[model samples]
Target: MAPSEKDARREARRRAAHRRVEPDAAPAGETAIRSDPIRVTADLTPELYRHLGRHASRAAEEMDLPRVPSVDLVRAWIRVSDDPLVWDKVIKELRRAKQ
Candidate 1:
């Protein structure tokens, strides 16, 4: 025995509806994480991702040791990369950490 066309259509609609937002209401004044998702258009090599993951892990470890604002971390990274002197200082600090 085969399923009817109506049954198939109903199942499809049900699946589509299920994919939509849930009906459960949320309490007022609740907020979630604010940072936007980072987009990457170009393909990232496996090595690049590995390096990024390592860098992020190290930064997270440092943050755990000494809690710092995410904005401050981002600003520091930007500033250091923009200035050769600051970049040198940052590299020195990283080397000191390894020692």
Candidate 2:
């Protein structure tokens, strides 16, 4: 098949085995891991003390950020956490937070 036809078929397959690669390489000194938005899952212990809504409220109040749902904060954290610089910030802030 032609190059374009192959790519089209791969895209339309809607299956992991038929994935097509697009050249969106990260720049220098950056990791290409998780370069695109993806849906990941976690089975949090719901009975645990802390939860997203409460944390989100506290973060908004302490950090003077907009009052959005805590899920947004968690999602944004996941997106940036792979970066070392941002990870450092996470470490700093988390260390400062109450354990």
Candidate 3:
């Protein structure tokens, strides 16, 4: 089959898998990782939470992934910002946010 045809088949399978689970619930056999007691947490404002959700949804659609969890995106950002330039930008943002 052509690549497009293969991708279509894969997408169809993903949709089918999604349909088998409840809309707001994790799929069967999936344990909730957040239930652990020793987890680090950050409090986000409602606006920021919604923004993250929108970004994650757009990223998932653009990448043709099943879902893009916001935590994963934040982790990627942290991983990529190891350079001094990135640190400077972060400090600048923090200073701006303080005003």
Candidate 4:
């Protein structure tokens, strides 16, 4: 039996998702890292949310980035936190906040 229109659309979408790009297809001076990114969620106050958005926007403009996603900024912070000095500072702030 012939597939219905819905089945055809589904097959097309599946094929599109599976399509792979050539390793060298990235634009000049750009490196593409293909990896599955997992989602991380955080709870923030409305004021903090606005602050994050504004910070990301300003950084994006200053750095000539096409966009500065909040996730990217948070990931950068995580990378920085790997340093002993930054880690210590974060712990100090946490302790002070608890007092």
Candidate 5:
């Protein structure tokens, strides 16, 4: 039996969703890393939460970092904590050179 119009539209959507890009097809100076996302939950005491808020605010003022929520700071730390060596390298470079 012939496929219905709805089936054709579904097939088109699936193809579009699964479309892959070749690295060479990217424009100059562009690179891409593909990975699945991970979700984690945290529970902190009220004191620690307050501490994080104060520290984040102080860092923003003293270090000129943008002020983000404490939870965001925690989330970002968790994300970048995977590579301590790279973090150290970048921190050293940033300290040596003006951003």
Candidate 6:
């Protein structure tokens, strides 16, 4: 006895359908982390915009890591530049990076 073409097609479809269905497993006990979105608006000169993009790309490449959101990076920049203490700390860190 041989299977018909229709039966083979149906069997293949059944196997594919079964593979597509995910197994319903109970979630392991784990806490989900939550984060709030930060927003900002800014206007930049063309040169400054290019500089920011390059800085962000270099930051991303240094560790072959995920890129930080531009908003977060910009917020960080503003926070550091606005505070003398923070700027001093940043300069110290940069000096260390050079060594």
Worst 10 residues of 1 by lDDT: 25-34
Q: Model 4, residue 64: what's the lDDT?
A: 100
TM-score of 1: 0.32
Per-candidate clashes, comma-separated: 0, 0, 0, 0, 0, 0
Tell me model 2's lDDT, rounded to 2 decimals. 0.67
Model 1 per-residue lDDT tens digits across residues 8-58: 866765655564545663332232222456653545689866665566667
lDDT of 6 at 86: 81
Off by over 4 Å in 4: 1-37
lDDT tens digits, residues 1-99, model 5? Answer: 357886986676555444435334544223333344767776778987788888789867876777867666777776885798868976887789675
* Candidate models: Cα lDDT each: 0.62, 0.67, 0.81, 0.78, 0.68, 0.69
TM-score of 5: 0.37
Q: Which regions of candidate 6 deviate over 4 angstroms?
A: 1-38, 82-99
- Which candidate has the highest lDDT of all? 3
Q: All candidates' TM-scores?
A: 0.32, 0.37, 0.54, 0.54, 0.37, 0.39
- lDDT score of residue 35 within candidate 4: 49
| Best of the two (3, 4) by lDDT | 3
Across residues 1-99, which tens digit of lDDT does each residue of candidate 6 receive? 257986986676566556555476323222222244656578998998888888887777885877856665677687778688888888898899699
Model 3 lDDT tens row, 29-97: 452223334556999999999999999999999999989999889888789789889989999999999
Residue 41 shift from truth in candidate 5, angstroms: 1.5
Error of 3 at 35 (Å): 19
Question: What tens-digit string does per-residue lDDT give for candidate 2 at 33-96?
Answer: 3345777766667753257767888878988877867668787778989999999998998999
Off by over 4 Å in 2: 1-11, 14-38, 47-51, 62-66, 85-99
